[model samples]
Target: MRVPANRRTPLHEIAHARAGDKGDTSTLSVFPYRDEHYPDLVRELTAGAVRRHLGDRVRGEVVRHELPNLCALLFVCRQSLDGGVTTSLALDAHGKGLSSILLSLEIEVGEIEVSPSSPPR
Candidate 1:
């Protein structure tokens, strides 16, 4: 994925956040390869597919943009919100019948704290 030029966060910030902190809300980055012939992976990554892959911890949101080249799906999930929390699972295409064709899959989770609206900086 391409990051906006003005953005300050690093490309691997999400992974770092997941590893450095616990119990904080996280944003996960995912990239899945559905098929070899397809140019994009959206057809393979349906809402149900994402739900099943992410399990029960997350809720998915569809954010549409005018840029045809930039299509994406976002998922929001809840974390401990207290202290020291950990969750894990295996994400191979065992039952989904996509084990053989799936060439690449990546997931990154990070902690983010959103508060009430702040005054202009």
Candidate 2:
């Protein structure tokens, strides 16, 4: 079994994210800044973890989709929007800020690991 790393860091430090919304569902895709960190993310960035991190913002479900070839994880959040973009009065009705919010979640990471100065495309 793998033990948690000593240091805790926000996901944004290790990865970048993009967000989209359709109706009341929000989708956020996260890609590691370095390929080597993919495994750690895969192990720690779970649906429950995201759901818990998102808290009351997500009302229905959070599903995690693994994209190993791209070293990415996509989270599909349901009932996250107050209504759709057309109906919600939220400041972020489009849910574009959801990516930033998800990136704010902190997770255990290796002490030896250093975030890249710039993320790769």
Candidate 3:
């Protein structure tokens, strides 16, 4: 799914997501928007605020992608002991603020498993 470069849709607002197997690792690709604001949202969410919220639940490398007018953040989080990946998204005031411009935000979650033969043959 390709978002244009004008509309501003929150990541949680993503309607559809897909998780697929990729050579022993799960791959999740989300189309948070159909317009431009995707990159901004990706940037803001992957920053300190969101990272802090994730805490120890997240591990491994975090990769970010930016285009002329597109952006995305990818993280290889640790699978929970329950064998599921847990995730969450929250929006609140930055500092000494009263109200937030973000009335509310949304989040989408997808999961995939890696294939066994992905590694060395």
Residue 116 shift from truth in candidate 3, angstroms = 43
Every model: Cα RMSD to truth: 15.5, 4.0, 15.2
For residues 1-121, what per-residue lDDT tens digits would candidate 2 score against the true structure? 2334667888887789999999999999999987877887898899999999889999999999999999999999999999989999999998898899989998877643543574344
Q: What is the C-alpha lDDT of each candidate?
A: 0.30, 0.87, 0.34
Q: After superposition, how far is residue 100 of candidate 1 from its true place, in Å?
A: 18
lDDT of 3 by residue, 8-72 (tens): 44444442233433222233333444444454456454534333444443343333333333344
Model 3 earns a TM-score of 0.35
Report the CA-based lDDT of candidate 2 relative to the real structure: 0.87
Off by over 4 Å in 1: 1-25, 31-39, 59-68, 78-121
Better of 2 and 3 by TM-score: 2
Instruction: List residue ranges in candidate 3 displaced over 4 A.
Output: 1-10, 14-28, 47-50, 67-73, 78-121
Could you give candidate 1's per-residue lDDT for residues 1-121 as a string of tens digits?
Answer: 3333322332222211111222433333323222221223343444454446445433334221122243333333344122223333324211222221112233221222223474211
What does the lDDT come to for candidate 1? 0.30
Q: What TM-score would every model get versus the actual structure?
A: 0.28, 0.87, 0.35
Which 10 successive residues of model 2 have the least lDDT summed? 112-121
